[model samples]
Target: MRGSVRKILLVFSFVLILLGFWFSTTNAYTFIKGYMLFQTDQTHIVNSAEEPSKQHKDNLKQKKLYTIRPNKGENIGNLLIPKLNATLPIFHGTDEEELENGVGHFDKSVLPGEKDNSVLSGHRDTVFRKLGEVGKGDTLIVETSAGSFTYKIRHVRIVDKDDRTVIVPKPRATLTLSTCYPFDFIGASPERYILVADLISQKLT
Candidate 1:
């Protein structure tokens, strides 16, 4: 009787181990595919209200934060890269799951064109794969339903994981782009690649 009980316990443990392994592998693979899908279909501009904040920036004057939300009857402002002549979707409220589709608005960052800096992030392998292809003078366009805002790539830098300061919101019209570094390395990336952009102009749609 004791032997039979021990055998049953061993079988259950084995089954649990197998199931755990399967779940982990499957989800990781799904997320990787989601990384590719992240090029488009991941914006929720429903956060259409601005708030007051007191954060300091390395540049620009202080101002209130702008609010954002998905377009109601309006369309999502498109994201275009002049160098690749490539374009994709942009949306508000970028979350972990939403990142599986395309560009995600950094919920912590300021909204576009109101006051402080508006930062956006996406998977480098998917939406931002071409981002590495952008040169210093290359152009990034965010055409909202209201107007089109242009930004020129100013500088790109790689930093350690502890450096979250690079993404702080400033009082200027700027765009911040970030992704994991050493793009080809497998099994978790430890570095960050960041792009700093200066707002060039805003054209009404």
Candidate 2:
């Protein structure tokens, strides 16, 4: 009787372990699918414009440039890092769902290409996994309805998560990308990785 009970317990434990693994794998697959949907929707926004070339050029020439202030959860634009080959949608706020889908722009900062710092944040495991791989002089491009702003990386640093100086307003057009440090960490990280770049060019289109 004792041997039979031991065998049954071992089989039950094995089944529980397999079930746990299945649950974890399913969750990860679901999350990836959701993120891919976000990317597809965002890409369509830019590629599906209805205007013709002449009208688009005329509008670009005549339209007055101003800052775009997006509400929380709004899709502001797309961020592209050429070196990292990362193209992700930029959302308005850094809330949980926002970062889970793509990068978020700080509402307090100016929009990209504006005169001041434009702060963007992303999750280390998601859109910004290759952020640390970017080096100085790499280009960061932000394409928006207003225009496209290109920035060249100038500095990179690892700072405490509470550091506010990195996002402070600057005198010139600056871009800051933030992600949690130790990209492979299993749990919450205490440090942040920052990439600072200066606007090298701008195209109003």
Candidate 3:
């Protein structure tokens, strides 16, 4: 009888140990599966959050790539000076021929309304005869194939004829108009009259 009782007790203890091992194994697998699922959800959330920003950058790149750039000497647009009640044709190049026709866009600079500086030059005797009348707080409107951009004159500068600051890059869209200083001078002027304007509004075509 004593031997039989001892065997039974040993067998019962073995069964309990096996049950504990199975429970522990099942718990570990459940924990690992839950952790993997949580990580997958987090990865999906991150991708979703980044998609729109990536798409916006791609769209901007496409627009920049496909933009139409005018050829040198092309008729690109017109400039309207409300203060002077005048409208002037704008050509792509600043050569003598372009200046004779109307406002001449410096070929080295960006187009009007684009970010950075857009330089327009004309003879003091002709196209810009009355530019001196337009001063700060005045408006200059540029109508182009891309849009109509309105700029408000922020500064009027009289710099040396050879000054290169008139064509320097700007932090935002800017319009720089240049003409010989001393609008009434008899011969070639020694200085340049400059109107620096900041873009105030735009109407895309």
Whole-model Cα lDDT per candidate?
A: 0.71, 0.89, 0.92
Error of 3 at 99 (Å): 0.3
Clashes counted in candidate 2 amount to 0
* Model 3 regions more than 4 Å off: 1-12, 55-66
lDDT per residue (tens digit) for residues 35-70 in model 2: 999999988875676446657888766345565457
Error of 1 at 185 (Å): 1.4
Kindly list the per-residue Cα lDDT of model 1 for residues 28-104, writing each as its tens digit: 99998898677443432222221122223323463332235653222355677788888867666567655676677
Show the colliding residue pairs in model 3: none
For 120-144, candidate 3 gives per-residue lDDT tens digits of 9999999999999999999999999
The candidate 2 region of ten consecutive residues with least summed lDDT is: 60-69
RMSD of 2: 29.0
True lDDT of residue 65, candidate 3: 16
What are the models' TM-scores? 0.61, 0.67, 0.89
lDDT of 3 at 76: 92
Considering summed lDDT, which 10 consecutive residues are worst modelled in model 3? 59-68
